[model samples]
Target: MIAISDPIRIEPWNFAPERSNFPTRNLPNRRAEIAREKQLTTLIRENNRSRRTCASKIAEMAKKAGIEVKPLEIEFIAARAGIAIS
Candidate 1:
């Protein structure tokens, strides 16, 4: 009869999942909102300047043509010209 061989043994160990101690906040979304607001503000300012320039040009043209035009009338006409303020 042949001699019997010993069987291999395996070791067992305890494993635990990792945990975090700090809470997370949605900071990136807030930053994006603030950035969009700033961009809109800048666009409004630029649009206002452009509107004023266009109004001034119209007033100058009317004046050179010897036509009577009031400042309030020019302002009203310019206000009717819509700008993409968004």
Candidate 2:
């Protein structure tokens, strides 16, 4: 529950399989972005997929299609679609 200017991901504890420690909780004064983040996280949990997994899949698929997508861009696209792609 802390404010962070940039996104900081926290891994789930070994003992807590159902939770993760996300450091970036909110923006300075952007409620909309915060809400979207919350929603996106929820969607990720529901899908039972990790950010890395989604990003890798995206990259691989794009590469196969000769799109040459970058990691950062892939992650951003996944996030917008409610995917937890790092």
TM per candidate = 0.30, 0.33
lDDT scores in order: 0.47, 0.54
Candidate 1 achieves a global lDDT of: 0.47
lDDT of 1 by residue, 23-64 (tens): 134356557655644543343344466444454555455667
Cα shift from native, residue 73, model 1 (Å): 28
Q: Taking the candidates one at a time, how many backbone clashes does each contain?
A: 0, 1
Cα lDDT for residue 10, candidate 2: 85
Which candidate's lDDT is highest?
2
lDDT of 2: 0.54
